[model samples]
Target: MFRCARAFSTSPLFKYAAMTCRQYSFQVFRDVPPLRQMRRQLLLDRKTVGFVPTMGALHEGHLSLIRQAATENTDVFVSIFVNPTQFGVNEDLSSYPRTWDSDVAKLEELNDEFARLGGDTGRISAILAPTPKVMYPTLPPSSEVDGDGSFVTITPLSRKLEGASRPVFFRGVATVCMKLFNIVQADRAYFGQKDVQQTVVIKRLVQDFYINTDIVIGDTVREHDGLAMSSRNVYLGARRRAVGLVIYDALKAAENAYNSGKLARSEILDAANGVASRVLSEQQALSPSERALYEVDYISLADPDTLDEVETIDPSKGAIISGAVKMVPLEESKPGEDCGLGDGKVPVRLIDNLIFKPRP
Candidate 1:
């Protein structure tokens, strides 16, 4: 039982990240003009730059991406903008954990980590903490756009998976990423593999739009107990956290099935769904207010490239098995409050994925 007790809990590898962390000096660019100016300078100087774009709340998963960005680029730039265009009116964009100062502190700590490792260029050079006013300057920050300003949407692709749930997600992601990629114009940008769909979308965005930056994807970092690290994990209060392990367990079941040579999609999905079904069974045994309201959204087996749902595993070309479980905490349940991601409550959505590979 990997029963983690608190929020933001992580492995010992990050023992001193947010705690005992030294604040290193870095540029905090808040507007477009200055950030663009700095970027132009970087390009003129022919210095290799790496970009790591993020929403505020910093965690180990985020840091690992920055670490990779540092190792490859002469300068690294991070953006911490909680994009309003990304969230629907009913979503928890307002309550979506914004630890700004702490986030900067984490970046400082990361820069210092690189400094200790005997490298100067590995440190983050600046951050674009733009405001809603600054980011959405003229365009309205509403997902329900009336097609006024230019918006990016990769049809069909943006309409599936996470997009199917929040139709505006990938549009917002593409729009913001394109905007940031324009602003920073870093030689390469870093992203984590955990947000698999987003990674696919961004890669397509760059390819289709002819964006200059290279998209570098680092492996997903996990907690000591194996849950993929996420900013939203904080919402999984102690009790729900334990049950949340079921999300990963389900993915593991699918992984095990595939590795065991059950290459049929039905076999793999059945194995995964069987593990996830425990949530419903467990719900019957718990009190209403104490339960982690896990309403199964989807357990998917799809092509890694087009994301088209697969019926059978293609050994020559692998597939990605992913799942999403909407978890709402009854203890803090607000019947009317919604995060847009889940039911009409501040739901703690759990999503995870694992790769299936056969040994040679």
Candidate 2:
């Protein structure tokens, strides 16, 4: 960590350049206390900090957040921790991707890009990648937490949409985020818009608790075919990636309907589900055993604040239009369903959404 000798500099750029004019060297802290001490030092030095938290398996989606943080803050801090509290009994906690080396390499590449730009602010300030023992010190070493420890759970919102299926999700998210926000004490924190409910939950956590950090939502980064980039996208074999496109298509369709003056909730949601049904139906033409099984888990039109399903569009206060799709290979399909030779041998859950505020 470099100290800012000229803390009273008039120009922030000059101050950043004065502080860091050498080759970029970022630190990765494995524990909380030391990281907290460093954060304190950054504040004392008056350096602006932007944070991005992830569960590793970095992708362009994550990089976009990091990139934005680098551009906006004097120093960028990133945390990569795979919290076990979020996973369920049958979830893939054990098999979830943990590309630590690759993640770091990607960060280094981002740093190089920042260097190429010749800007001192874009360098990644540091990384906080802690172990389970570090995050849950009181608990024993295990893949799943005991749930006996303290956690942050926002009611009704946590029980809706994705929460309806994965109950422990928002609790884990809120808890870990609170801990990180406290430790980093960053000026701002960044999150992707892909997880619409998640962004709402985090916003609530920050506001209710009066956390000092500002929450910045980055735009969702998608693939060439419009698939919203996600670390879990790795689960889909090369051939089956298109099967997941239905969610985004549905969301865009819903957004289009809302923009077209279709204000009724049914009209908006029907537009979305209508698109999804057609996509799934076309896939159905494939023999049950030949392609992946697709099911629309939920198509929701809800209050941006409460997450309660809404009956109509509110143009002044935009609505959150979202959907989830369950994609499983026919071979791995449950006992009742006939099996098929499909692209995804494992079950992959896809969620995507867009806000519905029509243009004037």
Candidate 3:
């Protein structure tokens, strides 16, 4: 009898063990199915993707866009391609920073936080990482025909300021960005306001081509000293760094004049020029190298939307006073030193914008 009891309790213990194992297995299976189903659903749903295309030495300006993208869309994709096509033969394409690994790491960290927030788990599915060839496929024999025949070429607006100088600059930017849009199929894209001209061009391109992606312009990031944050700032030495302030100081002078009721476009330009001239004159005593490596390219008050030069300030309409400055190399500097184009000196373009609202 005892033996029978032992068999029932011990030898038959396999049955009890099996029951417990089944329960544990069922729990494990239950946990997995939900998770798998959730993941599957996530994969199936069409996620709203956001894109921020940059030349990659990531900064707060870029991060601001990423954060904005995270808040607005289910997925955020960043492209770090430093497109060669966009840069003119004489431009700083080679010197442009290419901090790819750092950029990816930053994005990954943002993505992790985004995922934890129950924001899209797929918030940043892929970097849309591609080589220039992949992004800009093979073109036809003629340089005119871009790699893809269906390529978009945005012009007309390309005839202004920066465009006037860097002829093919916008085309390069437009093409690559469009290619990125095609690859990622982002529902929305972000850009910095600092590139006012670029912003204008991208907006026009999307509208003209009927590209479906929505473009968002983030505010320009600036240094505490008021210098606009740019990757090229790294080239500035200590003296040049201090001189850089002249750009903002000049803009502020214009702003002060406007605030003090200097409504005439000429007066505003004069104010800006005055400030810049005074600062430049003082720096001139220092060696040529000590002078701010920037020279007035042009200063004009213009219609904000159309970007056409305006004769006077119309309080009813907003206007922008924008221009570029070329850094002049010291004596012994080559012939092209003063101009941003063709070799002598690198240019640091400075633009300042303000709005004059009509008195109520």
Candidate 4:
């Protein structure tokens, strides 16, 4: 039996702050020993663990997943490690948001709500937030492809859609997630649908590896204007932020065209491209300081499962119409600074998807 270092209060009203405000009783572990010890204790006590892995910078989307995990399992473990492996060399690993203190506060706020509503039997038992150094003491040097240590790769699936853009993305994602699953060994894992391809890859990872974890996908949460909630959304300036909605707008356009008996794949893609063109025209009309913020990456219909581009939509099998748009700040328009493709313009790639099922 693994002896845990600490024990949570069994009282129904667990408190951390004063009576003026409710507080959570969840513990945060930065190393593996105490985390594993606690996990062993929870499993020995017949608890069903639900895991929500994240890269910190908590938002409403992340909160929704945590709430679901806490509600569904005997014990919930939320890991907040920003896996370095998942980020490409040109990606925003360094610029990525790292609001750890605020993230804890958000989780604690949710815990307080759960407690207030008589949350019992299931609570956010602990947080597994190890640093990259601690999590990967022998982590290889970062590279666009083929990092230092061994990695988990899902062929074909890992090489499509988002994979085509960021080659090493799934390799890093699969590796870190595999390590996390091995550590938590949770009964259920929750993921948001915003990264549809990522969810697909993880589901495949769980199946191919024979890991006994149920992958639960939460719906994609969006802003009032339809921009998908994402940590990188912060990088979008005010003008670019508004323009980011083009991704969702384009996906909706494609879905509408498909539902209206436009089954030809080229026609649907053209509809989405038209929306992108309209967005570009609008951006071009803005002041130079606020113009040139939108860049369309790719828009297409794909097999919902394989993520492969399709020639025609099969009414029986729904397809995912997804588009990616890269938005940059206006002020970063310099000769060698941010204008060129993949330059350090601090571009934010916004992606959105819609499931198109032909109506009978």
Clash totals for all models, in order?
0, 1, 4, 0
State the lDDT of candidate 2 residue by residue for 1-360, as single tens digits. 542221222332111122233233577776777778878888898888999999988999999999999989888999988777777767777667777667877998998888788756567878887767667788642324454777887887899999888888888888889888988998999999999999999999999999999999999999998899988888776435667788898899988888887889989988888888888788778775456667788999998889999897678788889888888755533444322223356678888988776445
TM-scores for all candidates: the values are: 0.87, 0.87, 0.76, 0.87
Candidate 3 C-alpha lDDT tens digits along 1-360: 001101111222111121122111011111122323433444479567777888877887888888888788876667666677777666777666555446656776776677678834436544443445445457521123233343456667676767777777777888777777655567789998777778888998888778889999998788888777776665554445567777677777877777787778789889989987887788776665335556777666666666677777776775666656665443333343342232334444445444444543
Greater-TM-score candidate between 1 and 3: 1
- Flag clash pairs in model 2: 289-340
Native-to-model Cα distance after best TM-score fit, residue 273 in candidate 1, in Å: 0.6
As a TM-score, model 3 comes out at 0.76
Off by more than 4 A, model 1: 1-24, 145-147, 331-345, 357-360
Instruction: Estimate the lDDT of model 2.
Output: 0.79
lDDT of 1 by residue, 72-150 (tens): 9878899887787777667777668767657877887887788888754477888777666666778667777444566
Worst 10 residues of 4 by lDDT: 12-21
All models: lDDT?
A: 0.78, 0.79, 0.63, 0.79
What's the CA error at residue 309 for candidate 1, in Å? 0.3
Model 3, residue 62: what's the lDDT?
89
Per-residue CA lDDT of model 4 for 20-68, tens digit only, reads 2223477767678778887898889898999999998889898888888
Steric clash pairs (candidate 4) = none
